[model samples]
Target: MTHTTHTTRTTGHVAAPRPDVYRALLDPAAIPRWRVPAGMSCRVHTFEPHEGGAFRVSLTYDDPASTSGKSTARTDTYHGRFTRLVPDGEVVEEMEFETEDPAFQGLMTITTTLTDAPGGGTDVSVLHTGLPEAVAPADNETGMRMALDNLARLLEHPG
Candidate 1:
């Protein structure tokens, strides 16, 4: 068997300031609202908003027919820690999936950078490294895009 490490990078613009965007990134209460992809939900079981702080979260597919769950039949669970946090500039996390499949066992590093856009809003860039071979690059990009979209909506129109 061959070992491979995949990487994915995605960027977007949110109609919000860097501080507000940064707050949304670390706030546990805001996680479930913005960190989830479409057709799924996020449940943050454990969260600590600081460097070296650990967090555990589960994403459950809304449709029972979805078979893409890495941890269980319909849920993808992972636990990791905040390796680095740079105020309103960046957030870095190291995480891995809870799965019995050998193809999905590995540590993934996610680095999210926030900056001011040229025109307006905040420029968000997310880089994912060390993705497992079982996860398609297209799927990962799609999920990240969806999550970014969700974050934008939450920050731009907070009711």
Candidate 2:
């Protein structure tokens, strides 16, 4: 049988320096605050920020019946490692879902790049490749966008 995979990309501009944005992306504590999409909550099971370090996280739908989850009825759990981290420029991770379904089996790669914007702040671009067939491209893009929005909000204002 031939294997197939999909890809999704999302971009956003945050009113913060590249260093700040890069820090937030690597901080385990900050992940749950901004990496989750609307209608979902995140939990960091394990995290090690260094390159080659492992991490595990789970995203659960606020409403269990909202959609089918890969790990459970309401949660999508995944574990991966930091493949590469270039200080204030980029981050690369390789992950796979914790599931039994054949449709959700694959090694996915997430590449996040940060660059300076014309006026100010940082331009963040995220590319997700090797997505499983069951994961809709539109939904994945939307989720990534929402997460970027959340990150922007978190950095633009501090209370």
Candidate 1 lDDT by residue in tens digits, 38-157: 999999999998999999999999998988899998999999999999999999999999999989989999999999999889999999999999999999999999999999999999
lDDT of predicted model 1: 0.96
Give the per-residue lDDT digits (tens) of candidate 2, residues 83-119. Answer: 9999999999999999998899889999999999999
Q: Which ten residues in a row have the lowest lDDT in candidate 2?
A: 64-73
Candidate topping lDDT: 1
Reference-based TM-score, model 1: 0.97
Model 2 clash pairs are none
The alpha-carbon lDDT assigned to residue 66 of candidate 2 equals 65
lDDT of each: 0.96, 0.95
What candidate 1 gets wrong by more than 4 Å, as runs, is none
